[model samples]
Target: MQQRRDKDWDLSIGPDTVRLFILKAKAISAGVNEDYEDGAEHEVEFDGDARDNHHHDGLAEEETEDLTARELRELIGDLNVDEAAELVALAWVGRGDYDASEWQDAVAEARQRGNRRTAKYLLGMPMLGDWLEEGLEVLGA
Candidate 1:
């Protein structure tokens, strides 16, 4: 892959937008994991075991689609196709799936993957915030 030589990485999306996304991702991550703070138990029901005791992994439905999730979704929903693709690429970079050296490749891959469910896809990642931040740092943005 050809190296991106300049300090100005040609991201279709702005760094401020990426930073905002980072903030929301961080909030969502924190909110989802918040319930487990004091050993708060969440109940999970299993099939064919109505009588059996339920175990909680703190991934309750409410937690999954909480205010943070909604806000994150809204934020993602507002992004255009190009921006969404860039966001995905950044997340992948942060996750160690791709290095900054392969930034263009990562972005191309993200573009090919489609951006229809970016919010859901990103929200599903447990470390979305950290990954995006890492990607930003790698890009020197």
Candidate 2:
């Protein structure tokens, strides 16, 4: 992998940070689907008192929102403009929107289109973490 060009662009965010972000994104995406055996492995019977006390769903929507999603929001919110743009560019590159040879172009576009809802935009991507990881690999960071 080739190192990112220092003369053309100065990426303030490090690879480690991107890696961590990708990890969190992956976690959140994976958590979207909870797969568990329905009495396939083990079975337990509950009495009336037990059933009455524990009659809640697996996880509420609000509870799911608080996990990796909130963490990702905070992470994106804390990033500066340049860092945020770089992240967007990385995602773009990873998603094949821009090739590694067009890294500068991707970064430039990211900066131009950056907004307050970067976290939301990023979260909307189905393979965000994979894309980001690919971008980092392309950048050789």
Candidate 3:
């Protein structure tokens, strides 16, 4: 991804930070819908009757998802009011609720909505990562 030039846009939060959030969001998305045994080969044994044995190794995956989610939540929670609102506005643009030309209006609306539940609201979106990435692209970040 190309770095956003300071002269080109005035962003409350850094693009790099947004990229990190995208990565974590994608990880959480994958972890939530993933099946542990999708492509693994299992050995079957015949002792009187055929038996299929495969261990469901979802515990580790669950833990990783939990950690990633926590990190994402923390990251969003730590942002300042302006930064958090910017994130919401970016998402709105990415989701097609607003066009890139309406960025200021979207940001104003996001700020009006407040950042009290920003993390929770953002985390609830299953397509958070994709939307954020699309938003960044739209903004030429």
Candidate 4:
């Protein structure tokens, strides 16, 4: 087993919670490119064209993705203002917007830009999971 890194700084949000967000974010990212129907089954009348009869796979996976997204949204929504801001700062750091040594400035900026739509903003990011993981690693958390 690999040795765990030591955490030398204080974080408003716990590492385990960040890991959970990373997991859910990765699931959402993976599902984004998959072909899933809009929860509808259609009977196509083909006019000698095979393209018209094309159907998407993974309805079950779509449902799971929906649930995971909802869970992630709720998790982010449930965090207090400080925790949410810290999370955003962590992402910014991970994305190379700021260095780990400038954590306090990042967190302050995040708090200044804090809003009720933190979850929505974060979920819209394509590499949220990877960024968050990188942030944690950089912080040695």
Residue lDDT tens for model 1, 68-96: 67877888889888899899998998788
Prediction 1 TM-score vs. true: 0.74
- The digit string of per-residue lDDT tens for model 3 on 1-141 reads 323323445899999999999999999888765643465333445566565454556577678789999999999999999999999988887888887778889899999989999999999998999989988888888
> Backbone clashes per model, in order?
0, 0, 0, 0
TM-score of model 3 (CA atoms): 0.82
Off by over 4 Å in 2: 1-10, 35-57, 60-65
Tell me which residue pairs clash in candidate 4.
Answer: none
Candidates ranked by lDDT? 4, 3, 2, 1
The sequence of per-residue lDDT tens digits that candidate 2 reaches over residues 1-141 is 334533444568888999999999988776654333343322445786766444545567548756778888899989998889899999998888887778888888988987588898898898999999988877777
Stretches off by above 4 angstroms in model 1 are 1-8, 41-65
What lDDT would candidate 2 get against the real structure? Answer: 0.79
Model 2 weakest 10-residue run by lDDT: 34-43
lDDT of 4 by residue, 1-141 (tens): 122245657998999999999999998987775443454444455666656665545577678889999999999999999999999988988888888778889999989987599999999888999999988888888
Q: Rate the local accuracy (lDDT) of all candidates.
A: 0.79, 0.79, 0.84, 0.85
Clashing pairs in 3: none
Give the poorly placed runs of model 4, Cα more than 4 Å off: 1-8, 34-58
- Using alpha carbons, what is the TM-score of model 4? 0.78
- lDDT of model number 1: 0.79
